[model samples]
Target: MPPRVLHFKSIYLNRSETFIDRLIRHLQRYDPIVATLFPKHYTENLPIYTPSGWWAWRRDCWLKQLNRTPRFLYGLCRRLQPALVHAHFGLDGYRLIGLARKTGLPLVVSFYGHDVSRLPDAAGWQRRYQRLALQGTRFIAATEAMKQQLLRLGFPETRIAVVRFGLDLHQFAFQARHQAGPRLLLVGRLVEKKGHAVALEAVARLHALGIEARLSCLGDGPLRNALKEKAQKLGIADRVLFYGEVTNEQVHDAYYTHDVLLVPSQTATDGDQEGLPNVLIEGLACGIPVIATRHAGIPELVQHESTGLLVPEGDAEALAAAILRLMETPGLVARLSYAGRLAVEQLHSLERMVGDVEAVYDDVLKCIP
Candidate 1:
């Protein structure tokens, strides 16, 4: 019986599976069992979709979680006898602090983009995050920007670790792109921080320059209808295709098929931003030129005019220029293509990121009381 980690997520996204699936694949090699809190995902205080049915849950489950949350979670932890508990997001971690105390299991909380960015600005958010930092035994920051944000929130530096979201290198095959047209691809939810609206406006700007470019949006969110309306009004609706959501296979295929990938990320109105958009790395892996903004830790990967072009946030004009530059520049595509793949291997490879995570897990478990 090897160690176990009871991974907790308040609600999981049905579209893009959380980091749990990826982490489980890698961490399973050590014979650790990873379990989830919401046996199936729940949204808006309701079970979104559950094939097995919620009633199938053990009778003890309710008795464990009924009166006291910490006591209930502690009983579950003791019954499962996991060595540790790993929670993603600051809010979730804060919620489980009592469970950690009651169970005497080390808790590792990972702070992703919005968890450390926009979340801390919410009412009473700072105090909650600070409490989580103090109670959590270990912390993982997806990027340097996230690490800095954690420090600013009063988290001890010694407790924080950097482990980026990684991609399977072998999954994304690199094809040296010598020639392609201005066909732009936008990946991620159609949210303000993802800059999908800005990408559409940039496509319109490219149209104004007489460059008949086609833009494909891969992923959907609340802004879907509104963005579609804006594109129609801009008259670029004919050129832009909105793909609501897609499988990983489809997204990987699009990365290779598209001429260039646009990840024009920016700070949203609520102060939400990215740590480092994975699409930039995936585009690089597919050997396509990526045009992203200097938002958060993006510069850590997409260096301006080196691996890919970096544009100013919300500047459709600059983004348009970058799209055209990649199309017209000879040998430029090939150069960035090679450089980008190398960056992923050296920085964001799944194998290495998994090793880093395993190391943290091992270290935490070793010191457990």
Candidate 2:
């Protein structure tokens, strides 16, 4: 009989939704029983438990409720009796570890960037929760940098595996370049860490240089008003268009419609940085050249000058120069776009990610005896 795996995540929204949902669908191919913490409208063969109603609370109360989630999760695990429990982030892992200890089941945890960098600095219980989460389970780091952080936090090097997130190549196929005006796209939360300000500044500089380009901003967050103000102050608000929170299908369309994908991610005031934004891979997959910074896991996915151009974080001038170079060069975009698509197809395929995760699951299960 195939092994049964229960994947636990707090919220099935945005990127987490894409990752968990895709993993569940693929794992079904191996005949594994998939389970999640969030309840869905449809019961499509996957087991889901609507636990403790944590998703309904505000941020502070949510963290407080998460601190007391072990009892509820323990009951769910006992009822499901999964062969192994895989939690997507560290805090969820900490909760699962408590259940694992009670039921004697193996637990696997994945650490995405913000959980290790930003959450620990939030004070009080969040820091303690992260510490306990790191201490208890076999950890999966999304990047080598994250793996190093896990090791520094006292997890055994052998206990941590670096598994970068994967992309669906088919869904993001390369589209032929068209003369649809010189368009730049930024797709991510309008938060400080994502460096939307830097992107706006770069566009402002390009405009000052007499470059006529259209900028499209996708996604939304707290800094939306501030970013718009910044763009207007720079006298380029007319050229910059904010699309707000677009659906996944719209994101793919934006990628193909734009000339370049700009991801000027930086380490925020709280040390929050990206763990390889999916937009970079998705942009490249759509045959669009990218101009991103060498921050966090970005370099892991974008080969400098091969797949896309890289600039120093927060350096608007460098970003402007890269954008200008891509625009001025007639065929560089095509070359980089082709190379980027090939890179994603060869290395960042969803199948590759699921296979590595399955190996991790199998390894943890073997040590259970």
Candidate 3:
């Protein structure tokens, strides 16, 4: 039997964090049970451990200041006897470092975007991360760009591993797009880093150019109202349909129905950025040609004019031009779609990511005395 692994995320899951669910689901060599502070979206009904009641939560908070594991968490470790703990986000890594130390288990932390870019600036988190850098056994980066970010945060060079976001190709299966006009799909939370406002402006620009471009936004966020207002201000509110949050199945259906996929991500005002948006991979895998910004790790996958089109981040005019180019050029869409699908299949397959992650687990566990 495979060794049990404790997978920690502050939240059991969220709509945008399907990658975490996929990782825990597809892992072959490790039996993963989730541990979270707040639990939601447990449709899989996996084994979950959480502190129950306000007293338990308050006590855990008091314990953290002393650099001690929450008593409940310590008990859970004693009961489960997981060989290692894998924290999904850097913030959780910092939160659980004490628990890991108490259990004497190797802790592997996956640093997804905002946790590296924005979270450290929150009050005392920088110092907390410095301690995490010292105590965490291994760090997983989704891109070389994120690896540099982790190094800047003081993670050990030898212990950092780059693992690309993986996709189930079968789920996002390829479909040849041959449509008229433009039907654009932008998937991701309506947030600053996602650059939804820029996408709105671009859609408006296309409308002004006598191009009938319609955009459908999947996923929701705190910025939804602001984005809707911006779309109204841009006079493209009708052209932009906000589906808010939808199921993974619905998103896959959108990819198949839509002709173009837009990922206009940029650095948020708070310094939040993307490691690599899995939406781009899903779009590519579904053979929907993508147009993205040259921001963070996006260029690593989009590859400008090869796998997909890339515009300068936050450049509405440039984004409009990219959309117009796609609208005018059918062969470009077919070429990019084929190349993008091939790229993901070669480098970002679910099997490839699972194998790489298990290798990281193996490398970390080898140091056990």
Candidate 4:
């Protein structure tokens, strides 16, 4: 029989997250993946649960039986008899750990961003991660910084694998960057850590320096309204364009149109931080100069004017200065663009990343007694 893999996600598939979507699709290349999620009637491959509430109709049956998991989920796992249970997100693995124990199946959990950076510091999160770290078969961290962070939190270093989020470079066609009027682009959810407001402040500083530039934000979240208001208050409302909730094609188009990408990631008050934002890598892949703040794993990507420009987080003056420098020096921009693309092509290839993930699965399966 072919090796079947059961994938679990706390939420349904979100196409806006290109990396998540790409990872799911790539995993299917090696094995028959059955993505089980709380479905809103989505997908052609798998739709195990529906939004109509799995427990709304089965509460009485659940109370009678002392199973922590729903009857249908346990039955589904027994029938599939998957070789491995791969759960997305560090926190989401909390649910899968119990299921793995109940079924004697090994669970492999992948920690992206908040699950390692911020969630670990939250109330009761320490115990949760400790249990998963000790109980789960293996863990995957997208960046070495995150892996170290997990290790400091007492996660077994041997059990954690570092597989960065990679992209199919062929999909994002790169072109030479030329001198333009600083078309600055920022693509991420409108949140505190994303630094959308800081990007706007930087744009206003550019206007003050007599450098004409337009800023565009492509993503929507809880802070969209606040960011819009901040733009208006800065008096650069006319210079800024907010494209809330854009499609993947639209994001790619923006990368081609813009000269530079701004990623001023910072640590939130709640301790949330970045785990290598996909937009930064995507921008580099498109051959555009990226000016990301030196926060979290950003330094790993932007090596101080080597691959891309690095600036201090939340420093509007510094962010503005970097943007101005890129605009004034076309040669520097072109150099960084070429070097950045090469770095990604050589280091973060999609095929290599998928192979690394498959290696983890192979080792986990082989270790099972």
- Candidate 2 lDDT by residue in tens digits, 77-111: 67766787777777667656556777777778888
Candidate 1 lDDT by residue in tens digits, 1-369: 667677665545444554445665666435444333455432333212221335534432453344113334555566667778887677778877878877678899987788888988988888877778778899999888889988999999998899987888787888888865867899999899999888888888888878889999999899999999999999999999999987777888898778988899999999998877767777897798888998999998888878988999999999888888888886888788888889888898888778888889988977865
Cα error, residue 9 of model 1, in Å, equals 1.2
TM-score of each: 0.90, 0.90, 0.95, 0.92
Off by over 4 Å in 2: 15-17, 28-45, 52-66, 124-135, 176-181
Candidate 3 local lDDT, 263-363, one digit each (tens): 99999998889989988888889888999999888888889889999999999999999989888888888889899999999989999999999999999
Q: Is candidate 1 or candidate 3 better by lDDT?
A: 3
- Runs of candidate 4 with Cα error greater than 4 angstroms are 40-71
**TM-score of model number 2:** 0.90
lDDT of 3: 0.87
The pairs that clash in candidate 1 are 64-72
Point out the worst 10-residue segment of candidate 3 by lDDT.
Answer: 61-70
**Of 1 and 4, which scores higher on lDDT?**
4
Per-residue lDDT value at 109 in model 3: 93
Residue 176 lDDT in candidate 1: 86
List runs of model 3 lying over 4 Å from the truth: 52-54, 61-68, 178-180
